[model samples]
Target chain A: MPVYSEKVMEHFQNPRNVGEIENADGIGELGNPTCGDIMKIYIKVKDDKIDDIKFKTFGCGAAIATSSMVTELVKGKTLKEAERVSNEVVAEALDGLPPVKMHCSNLAADALHLAVEDYKARKAGKGPIGRVETPEHDENEHDLLEHA
Target chain B: MKIINFDHFAATKMRPEVREAMEPFFMQEYGNPQSIHTLADEPREALNKARLQAAELLNAAANEVIFTGSGSESNNLAIKGTAFARMDKGKHIIVSKIEHFSVLNAVKALAKLGFEVSEIPVDKYGSVDPMDVKNALRKDTILVSITHASNEIGTIQDIKEISKIVHENSGAYMHTDANTSCGFISTDVKELGIDMLSAAPHRFYGPKGTGLFYLKKGIRIMPLIDGGIQEFGRRAGTENVPAVAGAGVACELAKKELKDRTAHLLPIQKDIVSGVLGSLDEVYLNGHPEKRLPNNLNFVVKYIEGESMLMWLNNNGIMVASGSACTSKILKSSHVLSAIGVDPALAQGSLLISLGEDNSLEDAAYFVKELPGVVNKLREMSPLYEEVKKKNKV
Candidate 1:
């Protein structure tokens, strides 16, 4: 198994606010399945505050735990407060993620920030963007091994 | 919580009888096998006995078996050693794409040394066609190496057929990385008609750090290491006495009990394949259903990645392995899966459960019982699963 912190394992095993809120105010999805990680965030806003928040993730342990942690960190806070959350902050909140996994999997806060942006866009009568772009995986950057 | 090991391909617990055979070498009969002192008698005899035992397992002459540090070392010796020895005659090599890194990288290094290489591809079930090997052979193809079985996907290759093609068509020698199948399946060099084969004792419930390399008699190869004459001067190192002794016993036991072990494992392999695939949607087996090792089972569960599933199963007292990028040290998914045409997205979800003699039918049932919960939990949190469910609903 990957070397995950206790906090990461805890959040991965029993993630908070899993699943989606039907007819959510704003939904933000980040990453893609092809890159081996995809995270979607759903938010309910009331008077500039995040009334309810949940997430669904398709990824490794770090990705799921980071998504769960970002939800717990930003729920009930205003959009301004939630915008402060970043990949680094989510990783810090969960003790830390593996360095190799941090860049790819620790992006829940980016999804949350997109949700906040999506909500603001609707408030201005623009549009609800479905997904934020993530970088394409450069296959040449890694050395491949058969096992861990 | 009871710890159940399903990762037998990686390592196995040392059997009691093998340990008993090794005890005298650790402290009692500790002497250099190469020494001329009176104390060397027992250690030299022990080394000879180990060689005989290992040779018996492969149906090769005792003088043909050379003890090495590990299976990887043995493969390196077989590939690079053969290449360097025959570079005067030819500079071309042929290998299957699904071979272990040792064989693949050794050939790659040979490519750097001006040797040409052709990687034969596998079919959807990860079986290498003998005709591909026949076509890949050229006048300068001095070596052809393939895996006897894949540890990740569990597909066995037709080595004998391929070996025949190599010998009949060219002067190339045939080699196989039989590390995974040596104990679990039939790996007789004569039956396989291969000139060289590599095996490890650790995968067969013996000690680690000991490996056996069978070089057919009269075949010459350059030595990877240079030192005082040992292993017929082909491999140069002081023999690991205890490990060799344990490995010998392990090989002896494997030969004696191969039939019964296969019988016990075949039913469990079938049950797990049926049980997991039957209950789970979007899950598929990775290897040939009937042409695989008796103890090997691999699957790809869609939507969720394998490392998360491994964590959940490990938390629930079941230990398994995966070929996901997250689980790999280099963060790249299995090349074997890629070679077999599995989608990169689905290959991230690969899970391998390799059984051993110690694992009972109940353990297989327990894995079948526990795996669904783990897959369900991960799928529930998966955004892709939501999309899949939506697609199904619509």
Candidate 2:
């Protein structure tokens, strides 16, 4: 067993922000079946700021807790501010993750950045930021959909 | 953090009897076993006696056993040494897909050397069919290396049946990596028809850094290391005398307590399996339900990643393995899980609780009681679980 911090365990045991947002302004999904971690972030952007944020993560406890914490950190923040939310902050929010599972928090940060980026790109008339290409999909088609 | 540290795995510290048996080798008899002096003679005699003790446990002659640094080294020596020694006879080898990386990687290295390697598949329960081995054999095949028990899933293979098939076709040498099964399980080389076998003592309550490879006499194999004669010149290195003595004591202890140890573990294993299965929905047992090691309980919880589950359990003061300890450093799914056709999502959630002789019924009960809540909590936070749940609901 790897050493997980107390806060990480706390959030893992009683995680917040577990469900997806309905009719979300932007949806950001990252990871794939192959990597064994998949996170989907749902955001509701209002007045160019994140009015609401929620997440559903398919991963370890650290990952789910990180996703739950990432949502709490980004809600009510501007798209730019949310984009600046770092993996370190997510890990810090949970106290700290085991070294091997640091990637789980990183995925949480990545999901947030992706959702905020989608909001920014949509505001710029570049349409929504494209869906992230997983190992299985074609980037071109996904990018076209993002710009659609 | 809790003020008092409770390690579930290390709950039973080293027994006084085993520790006492190992004390003299370290304190007073530290002479090299190979030296010609009187002090060396005693250590050498002790080393030979350790060999005989280990051999007696495996039901093999003392001369057949060669001590090595680890199970991985012994496995490497067996596969590579035999391939090179018998190259003139054949350049093909067969192994099961669920074998440890030691065996799989050794065979891969052999392939790089231009040998034809075939990996026979296993059933969903991770048991290899002897008929698969028989069908995979070619006239040019020189060896068939299978595991006595899978490390990940704990399925005990039918070595006796597999060896009979190997012997019937082209007289291929049969080898088994018994690193996980040798001590707790009763192993008889003749009964199993194994020409070469490997064992690691650490898994059996012995000190680490001691392993044994049993090579039947007249079954020629080249040496992986070259140095002054050691281990009958089969492996060349100064013997780890203290560790070997500890291993011999551990083997003797295992021999005396095998029946009781297994009897005690059986219910714990069954309870763990039943508890996990009953508490959780969509949980799958990863190995042969009945033919598994008495101490092993492996399960795949669909929504949580294995590493995270391990971390959560660790935080709760439980010590368990997510996959083979050797492959835990990497984040990739277990090859054994993949080969057995476990879904990628569930494979990420695999957990193994390998009970040592010291693990009590209370420990198993505690894990069973605590684990479902952990899984539920992780799932509650998981978007994938939410999505999967939604999909199922619809």
Candidate 3:
């Protein structure tokens, strides 16, 4: 793979908002068992805005970078605005992930969405957020598996 | 920052002595060994000398060594080559779960060609059981290729015992990719009682694109690459004369300095292993405690991924390898860790550190001191870790 962009390397080397919110409005945890990367996202909502956000990622450098970039992208934005965040945007924020590491951006996006979903579900009086699994994987997953 | 090279399993620097030995062949003695000119004399002699040095190291005759492009190619040549040559006899081949990609893919390719493969499993330490090897064999099983040591986890298999079981059960040819253990451990073909073995020169401070496939005399193999008579016509191409000569010197040096090299490396290995395990929480070593390579250390840290750790280490100028999916070819989990029955999530946490002659005690100490903080920092941010912490409290 080509060298990661300076932005990606920077976020990977020094991730931002790398912690959890105590008494959080909602929590989201996502895992890609095959790739052995998992993420847990914490959110604090106020006045319909995601007042604060933080994340912890247990995966590759790209995953951590994406998680960090996602938190920065989503924080202070309204929940609806945050929902507009996408994998491409997260990757773009990093300048670009190596094509192989693009899925890590998906994982980051999924975790953020799941956290938002959990917040909505709690307001609707759902008991607790359970672990979510995305069984479908892209073809790129196979390349990283075989090569890495 | 000083870079501590702990990815020797992936590749190594060519020794200066080996480079100097190969220098003449690249210029003055640049004739192809296949040519009948006087220029061929020097390369031919160098090839001959390399063959002998490799043979001496493996305790085999000069005729047994056939140079090849890479260790992976040598494995392809050994497994597929043998199976094709003996297809009329049997079509069954057996390889353990932790065999390198070269061996696994070669076997899989054979499977596509109508050959049956029995994959033997490994224990938690990544050690393949000899009894399992025995059980997996059948009358039609013609080849059993198990790695002598796992490059990922550093677990060394008991090839002598496995070879005994393989031979006793069937008329199977035993081949081990002993590249990881070539210099650090004993890989004598006679002592191991194996019929074939593959090794890469680059693994032991030799040139890349140079390796050897040890085919026991009278064990026929259909060549993978065909052309003019080279590698005794088993592989057809002009020999890489410089790499061959370089590899020969590297082998000679490895044979003489194996003990001292081991002595120099084992302490750093021990310090790093013990230090990391001692300072960390919920972390476990991946390979066998006693039977692992002296310079190898593999581990799984719970509730985290190896890539993050690798990044941290790289920032500190320490190079290592990870078993995380994102670091792999297809974003799939490590088969070696899974074969040992580890949870896939935990497998993402795998880290391997291998020592080279260049590493020192202080380097080991620096890694040991820095590793705990990285793990703890990642864990602290992990909500799963918070859940676990909460659950543990309850």
Alpha-carbon lDDT, every model:
0.90, 0.79, 0.86
- List fnat, each candidate: 0.63, 0.59, 0.79
- DockQ of candidate 2 (2 decimals): 0.34
Candidates by lDDT, descending order: 1, 3, 2
Per-residue CA lDDT of candidate 3, range B94-166, in tens? 9998889899999999999999999998988898889998988888999999999998888989999999988
Candidate 2 lDDT tens digits, B1-394: 4211122222224556657767888879889998888879767987888898898888889999898998888899999999999999999999999888889989998899899999999998998989999999999989999999988788999999999989988668999999888777888898998899998877777777878899998899999998979998999888888888877887787778889888988987878878888888978888897898887777888777776777667767777777521125455568888888987556777887777656666777788888887788677766667767789899
- If you assessed candidate 1 against the hidden native complex, which CAPRI class would it receive? medium
Model-by-model DockQ, in order: 0.61, 0.34, 0.64
Per-residue lDDT for A2-36 in model 2, tens only? 35677776776666776777878787888775566
Among all candidates shown, the one with the greatest lDDT: 1
Per-residue lDDT over B1-394 for candidate 1, one digit per residue giving the tens place of the 0 to 100 score: 9998899998899999999999998898999999999888898998999999999999999999999999999999999999999999999999988999999889888899899999999999999999999999899999999999998888999999999999999999999999999988888999999999999999999999999999999898999999979999999888899999899999999999899989998888888888998889889998897798998888999888998899899998988999987787566788999999998889889998999888887887888899899998888888888898999999
Global fold similarity of model 1 (TM-score): 0.95
What value does DockQ give for candidate 3? Answer: 0.64
For residue B378, model 3's alpha carbon misses the true position, in angstroms, by 1.1
DockQ winner = 3
Interface RMSD of candidate 1, in Å, is 1.6
Cα deviation of B125 in candidate 2 (Å)?
Answer: 1.6
Model 3 error, position B368 (Å): 0.8
